[model samples]
Target: MRQKLILERTNEIRCELNKVWDITKQYWYPLFECTREDLISFDSNYIMKSKK
Candidate 1:
């Protein structure tokens, strides 16, 4: 009975992780296309703006 409960909980966690993965893949694929220099520049600008 305890093992069955653990298995169910594991399956729930797997389903949540899959959902997160799908969302990240949809949203983050474009970021992956960015050049390293572009990412660095963006990050620096973001940091500078956030400090204000």
Candidate 2:
């Protein structure tokens, strides 16, 4: 029963990850193309700030 519960949670996480991946692909591709460098810079800055 515990194993089954774990499997169900894993599946749910996988589904959510796929949804997020799809949305990121759909929306970010254009922004990525337009400001590839700026996006990279912003992401790096955001990650650094978040770590603090």
Candidate 3:
């Protein structure tokens, strides 16, 4: 019963966080738009390396 309640609370927290992120994402900007693409590529490469 306690585990179920914990899971439910966790899900609620995650939903709230997603809502916050959705609002925050709209205001996020980069000095150069291209930098966002570079960061994304770098993140993907890092993720791939870590997966091995």
Candidate 4:
């Protein structure tokens, strides 16, 4: 019974992680097309703006 409960909890955690991964992929997939320089510029701009 203890092992069964542990397996059930592990599956629950896996499902939650899959959901997060799906959402993350949606936002990040587009950035895959960005050039390295574009990403660097974006990172620098974000840092500059956040310093305010």
Candidate 2: minimum summed lDDT over ten consecutive residues — where? 32-41
* Model 1: per-residue Cα lDDT over 1-52, one tens digit each: 3444588898898779655544244344345443223324246677899999
lDDT at 36, model 2: 37
Put down candidate 3 lDDT per residue, 1-52, tens digits, no spaces: 3455588898898779656544244343342233233234236677899999
User: Worst ten-residue run, lDDT, model 3?
Assistant: 32-41
Provide the clash count, candidate 2.
0
Residues 1-52 of candidate 4 have per-residue lDDT tens digits of 3544588898898779656544344344345443223324246677899999
Q: Compared with the true structure, what per-residue lDDT tens digits does model 2 show for residues 1-52?
A: 3455588898898779656544345445445444233324246677899999
List runs of model 3 lying over 4 Å from the truth. Answer: 1-5, 23-52
Question: Could you tell me the C-alpha RMSD of candidate 3 in Å?
Answer: 9.5
lDDT of each: 0.55, 0.57, 0.54, 0.56
TM-score, candidate number 2: 0.34
In Å, residue 8's CA in model 2 sits off its true spot by 0.1
